[model samples]
Target chain A: MPQPEYDVVIIGAGPAGSTTARFTAAAGLRTLLVDKRQELGAPIQCSGAISRHALEDVGIVPDDEFIHEAIYGFAIYDQTGERHVHDYRSLKPDEYGSGPGRKPLGYVVDRRRFDRYLLTQAERAGADTWLKTEGRGYTPTDDGGCTVHLRRYNQDIDVRARLLVGADGLQSQVGKWAGLQTHIKITELAGCLQFIVDRVETEGLLEIVTGHEWAPGGYAWVFPKGHGYAEIGLGVIATMTDKPARWHLDKFMTQSFFRERFADCRILEVQGGGVPLAAPLRTQYADNLILVGDAARHVNPITGGGLHTAVAGGKIAAGFITGHLEDGMPLRDGALRAYQDVWLDALGDKMWKLYGIKTDIFHNMNIRERDEQLYATMADYFSPTSEFKKI
Target chain B: MSKQQPVLFNIGWNACINCGACVAICPQEAGFVSPFDTIAVDRPCDIACLLCEQICPVDTITHVPAPAPATQNGAGVR
Candidate 1:
């Protein structure tokens, strides 16, 4: 096998890896993007609901078919079963629909299609792409580069790179190999189970219901993906007091509340995974290595949305790597620390505050009080005129 | 009742939801829900004000005051 040297070697072809590859390639870096799976975006694990601002920030505009629905606003249901609906259109006429008149909100995306679109974009940007290439391990070199070991078709191949990016998901082997703290406390980890069911008539609205009875420290989401397909799932924090997430998901899916709504639906895919609900790693970089996306624990503490953060982090990682390469600086602790600082400045404090609030509400508040306060806060946050601004 | 210095308790700010239940149920008017949207503990009037702690729905409130030193025989134990 011919040995190849790349300026940047990115693991996992998910959103983060692809985005990193795109940015680095565009910056004239020799980038190699690899994924373990034979296909990209298969066996989905996300609800794929992202804020409108996140998409525009990353410069990704979904085509009509890929966009399931344009969300009007949000409806939050509290533990006491009271619902509060906030329509952005009614509150802000200037931003209520698609185009100039469309609401400046968000869209529910078809995750699989979206991921594929991003990977395609990376390829077009000149990234050397390899599918079904599983990252085995890496050994840091004396000069501050890395020898990335990968397995393709059961054959081990070694590739060298000046920098390594681990965009792997929650259980990231890359993070471990790079000597970063990757273990998530049971309480901070959310075990989620979901099903993509077809033929379910769901409004173009996103629903988030929170309570111990429903999910216990987490929440259930109903995201419509058009064409009668919807991503429905529940996330439960794996705290000492809470049962396993699978049990809660099974109970919710079979319960009367969801059974009636999904009785006639066909199961398109059964997906399950764990998400780390913590602040981004205090140290996301070291010599010749950096982490992004779930590997860096960038998922939102409040909503558990990670796609946007992952993409953003990926772009930052690319920028940092480009600067390092152009300057011929050693990919040492100090060099990579710049990447960590930039990301923390971008979204760190917000995540920490949200984490604190999540713990407080779940542990101390009663159902009634918790519900009321949560609804009020969300209303204020999502309202067009509310001062609670988005980060 | 002799006036005593208020004992301050730092209720986990994260766990508080700004509910006035604790304030309403305090017999000594020692507990007030602050407008900053947090729970405050008044130690002066609270001869161990466990009411707010007990009524807390999430059990996030904890008494962090040190236990009084025990006396051995007729002497005070340090």
Candidate 2:
């Protein structure tokens, strides 16, 4: 009988995995984090916008290193070019902070730097990390642990661990291999595209353009990234259109009002990806295996925002795994099932309701006819004053 | 080097961003992120679901007449 090399082996070194490692390793567990990328956060897939409180929730402070710009609030534009601003200054003036010393409602971050910072924090907390290492698959052992197969340095390697944490993002193989039903339908997925452009004017607000005319099954956004640059992107449901997300974005930038605004702007970079709009996975854990972050579909159903949820999910995963190992709980088929229930109590309820609202608003509807009304409905649901309780 | 299996389609690497949407939604687990960080479909196993083609936001994965057999260690960059 051979002992496992590490107490826990976390696949993926994104925010979720790193946060999990930070807590588990700090608790004296032999935690190992693996990522396929040679660089920790290259080829960014996210918009990199997150609430300020979200970073703070995980004990992370907004620093100049990764903070791209401070967001004061959101400005939503309807199809008619009508605008509605949700200013945090009005709701929480004190927290908004004023002048150079002011705090922001949210922030746009440099994801590459932010992700690297998180992994560095995890390593500093005593976790071992392997870069350019991909988790090929895993096989659960009879002893209630698993052997993770990996491809590293062009060679295959196997590692045994008492617990396997699947923090892998969108294309997570670990969760699917673990039989968590991670499949997403075309209608339930948002195909997204973005361009980081320069020479675009931007205020401190996150600008959102809604209506099918702008984006058939999704919406477009202009998120400030500081220093006269911003990310302009949109997402479309593949089932709703024959054209790709890029086509819609192209039309939006050239045929719409943005044509004038982006006339001289330079396209610095292009980013694209798929976002799962489905409900969170019902079971986030199976035996000694736990799925956190996007792997567990912890994203906000309507907004498609997951950074905050990912960080929080990581913390929850770490807490439960640490507790299970410390309690000497039998690592059987259901030893860690409590993690999902706990996560549900903490965050899953709101997500489920939001998923319902998302279905009501976008699923199987005539978007063009109801565009403005739909935009108003969304605004009400998202307004700071409105309780999410209303349908 | 072991001979790789035959693939049903060729990935358009020039435009692919390695987002892994194909890998996430593939029913047969045939689509995977190659060691080079690009998306690759496992040979002799894709079942021609074409989900990868439909799900790719960039529309970079395309079906081909016959993909040349690959080697196990090759990056398959094409």
Candidate 3:
């Protein structure tokens, strides 16, 4: 029997895969997007904090319905309790530079709604959606395409495509199968646990606390989602420690500081996840394959924000794949290399540089010193009127 | 003519976080942490200057300058 065929078979229907499917299908390519999840957005692991620049980059306009809060700026505190508040709204253009407009820099988003919106967009663009289907593996065909093996609820099937894209999260089996190095160093991985609490009064400011007392080699964040709801979470660098992430989170959440602050709130949902604090992969593509989003390691090392990056990567990948298909070129190493070079040129170099600075800031200082520096620097770093602003 | 001695430095690989800060800021690409459990050092002769140590998160590295030459009598060394 002839194998099932598609112009593109994308794995893991998260932001990356969905965006790629939307763009490629709109370009008139036959696309099939698959995910293992029963629903579009469930089991949320992210803190859902994205930059204002990110939304604009992905062409996503935040409305009152989708956004949780409109954040003006961030407040940083150190181990010794020294606080520094940086208001992005009050900065002067001479001190910072251009692009420091009066708009909110970003907002905390509802992950479920945001993801579902992206998927809906993809569906509207004419891509076949395959929920509850898990990609098992793939074998390269002699005709410069690939035959993907998949299993759905104990039933096996196959799909053939000229190109494959992997947008799965941290534990991406697709990345591993594609022979990309997905090994995360223990210390570079931040084990995080978060809880969304309702009836929590927040001042529309994102709070970040740095110190060993809160989380070693990591920080705790309280992101206000507005309407008396907030997402509170902490992350710790996973070294050789045998303790789970929840243990550290429990230790911090039950402390006098957190208890006193959030005593009146009620827990709505508990989420735990791991984020990779590293630079984007040096080579995100191979023969007949491309990796996007978390699978491509496009996460920000400082804030762990990946939604925007994933969308951007997906758009770039779709453009490349569309061009390749148009030219009737086989998805060979040279063609994929072009895709890698263009994307990296656009985003990878800057991210790598930022990752370097983030590593230096976190690794060289003790908890107390880090907190102090953050408090001292945040004003200048984020203030529109400060010379160091531009992050 | 006097003889020259080579200096050495020991980097504790186990404590590295693979953050790449050292690689980015290092004037000499002497310090690099790979995801594959390998720490690459380009020139050992550059050990006299220990900039990477200052930026290291865990301080797992120690730079050892060359030891003074021994006396001919093998008594107390300089």
Candidate 4:
């Protein structure tokens, strides 16, 4: 009964939750960010490879401490061991605004530090944060808000807030309890495995290997993590195969292309999880509730990328919450629903395009046929432009 | 695609987040909620179908593949 009432309560302290808390509290509204885990970034559920613009786009400085490596382009390997190295080097600084000059394709981050760093930002902005707190559920209050039931280290408490934001990843209980169906189709859930290993022969380039033999309906990745350390992982369509991801990783490790190169490597860590890559949910906001990040299924369908979406989404959610709390505007139905409209205006087309590409191209093609067609197409696409007729 | 049906499937308690996705998506009424209403449980793999395995969001429901049939084909797929 002693828990303080707040204007906003965000469940889950990952990137999305922290970003929303950061902006909401900084705008002078009372905010609270809660996570079930003892540590902000424990278990390290991500590949640590995030788009370089993820931080800056949300107004955070991309500090050097968290950056592990800069990727130039991709080296794509197909089913038959055919390699197509494409040089889609990033654009100049002018293209992305006042950022670094001549950017790389992306960056590999120390995600543990990155998540904690964002938490610090939220704390500095005056948001209250609670770790090791799990949300049991919630019930509607008469004042148009809800009382969230929480268990803090075996002790139960109730906290009241006008707005509830669920950033609780793919298995969001907050969203489900708030009357939003958070489950996606099995065809849309991407089960993934990641391993941090040494002795990787990557030359500052990202490697993507695709084939049914390696990963069914998806590709395996080798991300450069600097200092000869690499994060290798794969996502397989759950509907495509019944085999465990570890079984696939063992087979991938023994491939002739990777056997000798990874011979003496030691695996530092292993993490497994699922990513929801369906289109952003039909409604991430209703009444006084909202969802963001993986909970809202905002991940890019093709690459399963989500860091950028989480940051952008957090910022957009805060914008709506702040306006409603401070400007004396309504917070239900039409006004609050605009949160989704504003964000889709900012990022909808890109997500839909990636979804189309994922469903239309990669997901439908069997491994062998995709390899042949992809190899032939990229071979020409990345080849030096040739002059057919001088006239 | 003609492998023998699995006789048993074990659900990993550690991997389950109790999302109720398996219960909602299973074609058969194999999945159910326990007494607490938080954690979920499944009946068994007697259906010979892998729908529960496919529908598990966390990949926690592991399939136990049946031993290879003695008369299965031996032709190389590649």
Assess chain B of each prediction and give its TM-score.
0.52, 0.58, 0.49, 0.49
Work out the TM-score per prediction: 0.77, 0.90, 0.76, 0.80
For residues B36-75, write the lDDT of model 2, one tens digit per residue: 4445544443355566777777888877544654668875
Classified by CAPRI criteria, candidate 4 counts as incorrect
Kindly report the docking quality category of candidate 2.
acceptable
* TM-score order of candidates, top first: 2, 4, 1, 3
What TM-score does the first chain of candidate 3 have? 0.89
Best by DockQ: 2
Question: In model 3, what lDDT does residue A165 have?
Answer: 89
Task: List runs of model 3 lying over 4 Å from the truth.
Answer: A92-103, A240-243, A256-259, A365-367, A373-391, B1-78
* 1 against 2, candidate with superior DockQ: 2
Could you report the DockQ of all the candidates, in the order they appear? Answer: 0.01, 0.43, 0.02, 0.09
Cα lDDT computed for each candidate against the true fold = 0.71, 0.81, 0.70, 0.71
- Residues A1-391, candidate 3, lDDT per residue (tens digit)? 7877899989988878898899999999999998877765456767776667766766666766567777877777775556677655554333322245456767888877877777777888999888888887888889888988888787899889998888876556676677776656656767667778986667667888776777776778888976778988877764523444556666666772666677677888776556667878877887788888888888877667687778888888899889988899868765788888878777776678768867777775465566555555443455557532222
For candidate 3, give the lDDT of residue A327.
Answer: 93
The per-residue C-alpha lDDT of model 2 at residue A179 equals 76
lDDT of 2 by residue, A1-391 (tens): 4533889999999989999999999999999999988786667778998888788888888899998998988888887678888777876787784466668888898989999999988999999999978888888788777788888889888888888899988778788776777777777878888999998999888888888887877788889988889999988877778877888889888887778987888999898778887799888877668899999998887778888889888988898889888887876667677888888878888899888877877754776656866678657655777675211
Docking class of 3: incorrect
Residue-level lDDT tens digits of model 4 in A1-391: 4767999989989899999999999999899899887766656657776656567778777677677887665677876677877554432334332245656656788877888889899999999999988877777677777788888888998998888898987666666675676656777776677788988777656677777778776668888987778988887767777775666777788774777777788898776666655777877876778888878877877567778888888998899789877776665764677888877887755687657655665544566676555445334432335121000
Give residue A67's lDDT in candidate 4 (0 to 100). 79
Q: Output the number of the TM-score-best candidate.
A: 2
Which candidate wins on lDDT? 2
